[model samples]
Target: MTPTDTRALVAIDLGAESCRVSLLRWLPTGPQCTLVHRFLNNAVETENGLRWKIDAIEAGLMEGLHRCAAIATEGVRSIAVDGWAVDYARLDDDGKAMEDPYCYRDVRNITSEESVHAIIPAAQMRVLTAIGIMRINTLYQLYADKLAGRPQAPWLNLPEYILERLGGRRVSEYTNATHTQLIDMHTGTWATGIFERLELDPEMAAPLVLPGSIVGKVTGELATLPAFADTQLVAPCCHDTASAIAGIPDAADDWAYISSGTWSLVGTLLQEAINTQPAREENLTNFGGAGGRILFHKNVNGMWLLRGCLDVWRAAGKDWSFDELLPLAEAQHTPHHLLDVDDPDLLLPGDMPNRINRQLLERGFGEISTKPEDAPAMTALILHSLAARYAQVLGAIADITGKKLKKLYIVGGGSRNALLNRLTAQATGLEVVVGASESSTLGNFAVQMAAVESSADAETIAEWAGVLRTAF
Candidate 1:
């Protein structure tokens, strides 16, 4: 590839609900972005359990890359990948997949958490990994596998798996690996102690690499594409939320971020890990982030709650679109039932409307209607509940971190919901700054540019990020 400062960069962002491949091309005026391709992503239900359609994802990604190559006549400098964390692909000795990866929502971990807690106890685990205890965490999933007599195979998280498929070395990105609850928060490395306690093979894990590190270059058939020739594969905060946080143009201390998507990760950046008793009790997590910062956040249930109700409606032959629902929701003014969005029951896939009502009744609140005509009320309820949770989490973050959070930045696809944004601002009483809807992709591009133009070191990448603010 030609040595040019202004070549295009491709960002592949994998989400639990959907995935998109974005092309960031430097133009004469500034940087321009094209969402080259996008598609709905879901876990396939099977006789055994829920599994990610990895083959379908691979096909979609190939088509997207072809489209990027067609449009990027000037050639692409490098590519990066980021995605949702925790779930991983198990590979055999020959580096072949054992089966389609299990979805994080699979119920196999329900009984697994108790077993894990028995081994290390929740309090000690939190102090060890500095991760919030959750059934969806990889540690529980792996323990579930062990309980089921599944074969011990090497594993790689989704983004890292994609990198390995792209001729990059097998390695886990720091930001995403923390979500697995397998990394030691203090050493910033794999927690070998946990591995020993659980009787898991430490060799199954790939070595940890920090965000912005160039893992490898485009090789095989992909390298033959004109746009991909000599393209380097950089890991940009491989966790999608981390990438979204990295994309925020401003780096002021007083502003916090909400990486709003299927899940709302609300928190601020920190320089060190917080493993105090209060943080553990509040279920706050401290994960590595871009620029050598720590992401101290809480995972609040987000759009998935509404999407669940939408699924129930569609399955009942009463389909409705967001455009149809949002306006109606905005038109309604009556008080609706509020929910604890993080209720464990709502985390599962099916019968969301019934689940919401069940939760309401259990909490001594009146149930709301889920009929197509009552979509407005149900939508309103979800939004109000989420906004309230955002406010609550923001307050806790301030108390725990002792940071005076003055501004809240809502970045990611959920930022487009004006109704929720208004509620978030009002509820939190903080200056709300709405950022680009494609924050994760933009952050991926920024890191790729830094890796190509200068170095991927945290300090250098952060300096380049400041200079490239106008480009976004």
Candidate 2:
């Protein structure tokens, strides 16, 4: 596994709205990438609550792997999985998933959020973990399970659980683990003090491993697939944002990144975590980034607003592709109601248009129409609101981290939105550079390659990322 190694690597990026399986096939000329498979991924509403379709996701992944094996006639070197953070799966003693992992958007966390905060206030928790106290964080979900008298067993983030299921060792990757609000930012381990105060068994947490650790070789029935045979299972930035940041092709500290998709993570990378009172009050989170960097950012509600609205529109027989809808939004020049995208009411499922209007009315603003013809206005509103929020968060990060921002890197599916990129640049007054649309997947593959090359150190990861990302 040297730079000259020609073996292919597979990267599975599990996203909130969709999941993708991509392959980097090394060739004599250069590495070539193929999107082996992609499938729509959505949390289904169940009798218990809204939950991820974990079984369906697993099946889809296997199908994708078989396809990759067929294409990569060259032997596959390794594989890795990166995904959204916080929501996790609880496993029993026998390594059985007790139930489907709850979607972070599920309403069940509302009650538990209060109880958990009563024990350890959000501000104080921020001081401990240096992570924003989101209601959907894994800590609140685990607290809910504890209150319901559920058995205490090993609980792993969704990606970690999937890796374990695939014969990789069960361990929490550091980047994703930081999102749980249970890890101490200073020590990079479970906050024993917080867990004790909340009566949680800290042992339930899997051992913390940094990104690029080789979990193990692929195992179980899936290993029988040609692509998985002898394939090492590696952990990239298990949190998609971390992976996306790692996939940045350039190296510089003056630029910020917005891992824009269902959620917009706006921040810059720092070597040290920020836990100042101002940072806590602003709800900024300091996540572990690749290359010994700290992801200092805010989690702003993103495309979920427009995505929910689009669902309502399509159900009403007003169907249009996202491409077609964007131009319509860009063409509409009328001033519209602005929304505080982070409002909790807008965080749930169903009738998003109405919820937005209600918020607008409460704010003494005119209500926008939900009709299909009004899609342009709605889309514009959502995009503008998001850009504004990004700017606000960027300003806060700059103030707190004392980093003078020079450029903004917009990555992920949302990077394709030309209008949003322009608006982001205008709102933040920083040049917005957009590319690496599949950054998380690229980072996933880069990390695997680093592990294979046995140069998985942070500096090597950053260097290898630039070379690997060329496949895109």
**Poorest 10 consecutive residues by lDDT, candidate 1:** 462-471
lDDT (Cα, tens digit) per residue for candidate 1, span 1-472 = 1225677888999998888998888777667788889998999899889999998998899999999999998888888999999999998766656789999999899989999999999999999999989889999999999999997789999999998888789999999999999999988989999999999898999999888888999988989988888788888889999888887767568988898989999999998989899999999999888878899999999889888888888878888888888888988884555788999998888888889899989989888887767878888888988999999999999999999999999999999998899989989999999987888887777677767776665565555555455455
lDDT of residue 45 for candidate 2: 96
Kindly provide the TM-score of model 1 when superposed on the true structure, using C-alpha atoms: 0.96
At residue 466, what lDDT does model 2 achieve? 81
- Residue 448 Cα positional deviation in candidate 1, in Å, after optimal superposition: 1.3
CA error at residue 421 for candidate 2, angstroms: 0.7
**Separate clash counts for every candidate:** 0, 0
* Candidate 2 off by > 4 Å: 334-336
Please report how far candidate 2 places residue 56 from its true position, in Å.
Answer: 0.9
Scored against the true structure, residue 299 in model 2 reaches a CA lDDT of 89
| lDDT of candidate 2 over 1-472, digit per residue (tens) | 2476677888888988888888888777787789989999999999988999888898888888889888887778888999999988889876868888889888889999999988887777777888888988999999988988987878999888888887889899999999998888998888989889999999999999999888998888767877667888888889999999888867777999999898888888888988888988898889998866899988889888988998899999998687898888888874656799999999999999999999999999999999987899989998889888888899988888888899999998889889899989989999899968898987887777777787666777878888876788
